[model samples]
Target: MTNEASRPAVDLYSDTVSRPSAAMRQAMAEAEVGNEQAMEDPTVNLLCERVAALLGTEAAMFLPSGTMCNEIAYRVWVDRGEEIILEESAHALHFEAGGPAALAGAMVRTLKGRCGIFDAAELETVIRAPRGHHGQRQKLV
Candidate 1:
């Protein structure tokens, strides 16, 4: 008993649908897990250290999800009531449930781009000089 509609032509919807290899599952089962907040997680600490070394950074912090990373980046780069330019098809804009606005108090200005990447001309069009106190400050892209 099978239904053709039960499966999709291309299943790129989410990371959730993927299954781990046997070795990966074994590694997870044997992993030394601890509290990330207290920096007691040896695995996380090692991963961060290695990533930092590879990226030529002094230190690195780990975030579990892309959504959290985006929020953290928004907080770090843009202040409240500021603006961030994103492509119309960006995950933070659509999938994150207005995280740019709600989490960081950011004003989002989306530019329609080819394959989610906008060019300089498109960018130049949206960017405005500080209009007035009433106008939003243009921040990160």
Candidate 2:
């Protein structure tokens, strides 16, 4: 692996890290524009339609970013006081800014893993009850 100092310098902290290519700039300049907030934007509509079809789903929505997408999914999948089973290092749990608990009103059932992957037995064990009524119930999310 390349050392940090030897590797090509590029920002990895956010999507704003890199500048747009000339081709992308030209495309944007030539693309048709419409009102996104009013739901009339052609580009946004095409993205939603394309993703939904590719995913074999009947409906779709274009969220601003991955965090927004995860937050929206969390809100829909969770109920008040419910818990979701997730890998301990998963983006939904770590990088989502506490959206599961804050926006969805749900708790996390974080399971430890090695190299971001978990075994079936480990998942099953984590899903088991906490031996009392006070334990939070786990959901698939």
Candidate 3:
């Protein structure tokens, strides 16, 4: 069996393998950098506008990472004490390490499926029927 030291040096846990190309580096060096939270940066505003236009939406905000995006979405869509229905192998279930419960105050109900994909019928099976304040409500999928 191969040991840990025998494995390749490349890291597979995160998306840090790719390096910025020379053109990208030059563009970043020349591009105007600004405070994104205050919406004062021209580059950020342009990107948001471009994305909104492309998606036919009124506005869009650029997030730093996918984890941030997921957390924000869960906070916005799921309410406190509510639950999210997802597959057993979902990234949020395994990777986030209880962020949904801690940050959003939401719980997860996982369904058995293949490759994190489940059917509507399978979802309906696990849904908690509205029993007036007895159990956590399933809110977002």
Candidate 4:
């Protein structure tokens, strides 16, 4: 067996494994940082505006990570006791560690799909119809 020290340093664990490149480091150094939550940061406001324009939305808020983005979206769009449909191996379900249930009071219904992708027909099969108090309302996918 190879020694641990001799193993390649490439980490395949997550998207955040890489350090910022020189250009990114330079940009960060030059950035005009401010309190973003106060809505007074000029650089953040500009980035939000640009992203909003690109996505054709009214506005956007730059979040620190995808997990925060998912949590926020779940809080906004999902009601308590509602269900979100997803593949069994979805990051929201597995990686986020039941954040939907803890944060949004939401539940998940998973589909059997290859590589976290499910077809529309498969989605249709699992969707809970809007009926009186039988199952949780299907909110987001």
Candidate 5:
């Protein structure tokens, strides 16, 4: 027997559904603006530096979406014919909606795991040099 009404559904949907508050809009309007591509945008630069420092990364670049960020990272890490190893159910794989393949021109080796966490053993299996039996092995993001 199926209790359709009693089923608990989780909204694993896009974050763009969130609307900015009035205060946030006002803040944006008041925010000082500059060219983003040149890293001359003060706000964007500050945010990137702040996030990079928090995450302990060498540097960071601000972009419009996580899809863009992930795709850009993949492109930067690997050449046109390389590949990325990630969890089978990672946001980059499922949620980005093919941004990796479209943007980076890279193959994905999706390892199995629960939720989004992959074990070291599973990762070890996938992280191999792409060769005669394999493909292009380049980067992981």
Candidate 6:
């Protein structure tokens, strides 16, 4: 029998504890920042432009965080009172304080899966067709 111990050069468990390098701190200190809501932030614009070019898309939006992205996407793709299917362990499902229900006015349908992963067949089962005036439509996953 053998016992071994290992130490990591860097830990990546959470961004809350991550520290910026001196170079990164310097860049942040010198960065030109502007109102991002009006698309006046040159840094955000450049990031979006570069991402769009890399992905071969005409345009891309630069959102500050994953929470914002989820809310925006849900609002765009799913109408009010519509249903969004998600794994029970999904970040927005568990951590976003019912954002789908509150922010997007969406009804969340959770599916149980091993390690937050479900097969296509399981997904197909929950997919509901629009029953106009009768039921909330299932629009997004």
* Highest lDDT model number: 1
Residues 111-140 of candidate 3 have per-residue lDDT tens digits of: 988867889888878986776887788889
lDDT of 6 by residue, 51-131 (tens): 999999999998766788899999999999989999878878887888999999999998877756899988887876678
Point out where model 4 deviates above 4 Å: 1-15
lDDT per residue, candidate 5, 104-130, as tens digits?
A: 888887888887787788888777655
lDDT of each: 0.89, 0.78, 0.85, 0.87, 0.78, 0.85
- Best candidate according to TM-score: 1
Q: Write the per-residue lDDT of candidate 4 for residues 6-103, one digit (tens) a residue.
A: 75598544667678889999998999988999998889999999999999999988998888888999999999999888898888888887899998
In the predicted model 5, the residue pairs found to clash are none
Task: Write one digit per residue (lDDT tens) for candidate 1, span 1-141.
Answer: 868798776665455766778999999999999998999999999999999999999999998887898899999999999999998888788899999999999999988787578899988888889979998999999
* Candidate 6 Cα errors over 4 Å, as ranges: 1-19, 129-132
TM-score of 3: 0.78
User: Model 1 segments beyond 4 Å from truth?
Assistant: 1-14
Structure candidate 1, residue pairs in collision: none
Query: How far is 46's C-alpha from truth in model 1 (Å)?
Result: 0.5
lDDT over C-alpha atoms for residue 9 of model 5 = 65
Per-candidate clash tally: 0, 0, 0, 0, 0, 0
Consecutive 10-residue window with the lowest summed lDDT within model 6: 1-10
Model 6 clash number: 0
Which TM-score value belongs to model 5? Answer: 0.67
Model 3 lDDT vs. the true structure?
0.85
Pick out the ten consecutive residues of candidate 1 with the lowest summed lDDT: 9-18
Question: Ten residues in a row with the worst lDDT in model 5?
Answer: 6-15
| Candidate 2 steric clashes | 0
Candidate 5: residue 104 lDDT (0-100): 82
